[model samples]
Target: MSNLQQQLNFVLEIDRLKAVYRQAMVKSDNNRFENSAEHSWHIALTAQILSPYAEDGVDLQRVTTMLLLHDIVEIDAGDTFAFADQTALDGQPEKELAAADRIFGLLPEQQFIEIKSLWLEFEAAQSIDAQYAKAIDRILPLLQNINNEGGSWVKHGVSKTQVIKRNQYLEKSAPKLWQFVLEQIELSVEKGWLKPE
Candidate 1:
């Protein structure tokens, strides 16, 4: 196939991401669960808007790109709830890596390598860009839960301690955002949205 055909095919295949539902509900859409595609878009925008607060010298464009491509693997491996226990998460990285290989392989060779590299960088969350992107990614779900009266936290019986432990990395990537998260957790607990233990 021509490069154009390969690119177009990849684009068309990724449309399936819209159908992959996540545990978090859309805050503005009543109680509807958010899809992977929407989650990607929201986090990309969040990265852009929050970039100024990221570590000095962070690349906003790369962070946005990482956020945009981070969840494409969910199209195949499916969405894993953030609160799932370790048993439920076993082998998820391998499954997602396989999905990445297949999904990204749909692109032309060079494009595949570049996109896959960005996805891997996001997964590693080591670089400044990836760290900022990851911080923004984690923020959106908290905002969704807070807006929807603890949307997934309530449904999954998640506690404040669990939420903090899961997202503690945000403190290193975006200290200001981490403070905001802490305040929100306290507020959520006060509102009876999240368990206090």
Candidate 2:
């Protein structure tokens, strides 16, 4: 097939990301559960808006691209809830690698490598751009949960410890955002959405 056909096919396949619903809800939509596609778009926009706060001065374009493609693998590997058990996440890395191969491989060779590199960078979360991307990615879910009166935390009985544990990386990437999340966690407990312990 031609390169254009390959690009088009990849675009078409990625549309399936819309069907992969995440655990978090969208506050503006009457608490509707967010899909992977919506979550990806939101994070990319957030990266743009919050780039100034990135600790290491990331490349906004790279961070946004990473956010946009980060969850595309969910189309094949499925969405894993942050609070799910290890058994649920078992072999998830392998599944996502396979999905990335099949999905990104649909693009022209050069495009495939570049896109896949962004995905890998996001996964590693080591580079400045990737770290900022991860911080923003995580910040959104907390915002949604707080906006909906602790939507997922209340529903799943998620605890403050679990949340703090999962998000400690925020302190390194964006200290202010991490502080904001900490404040929200306190408020969530006061509101009876999260356990005080």
Total backbone clashes of model 2?
0
* Candidate 2 residue runs with Cα over 4 Å from true position: none
lDDT of 1 by residue, 94-193 (tens): 9999999999999999999999999998898788788788778888888878877788898889999988986776898888889989999999999998
What do the candidate models score in CA lDDT, each in turn?
Answer: 0.88, 0.88
Model 1 ranges with Cα > 4 A deviation: none
All models, RMSD in angstroms: 1.2, 1.3
Candidate 1: worst-modelled 10 consecutive residues by lDDT:
24-33
TM-score of each: 0.96, 0.95
Best by TM-score: 1
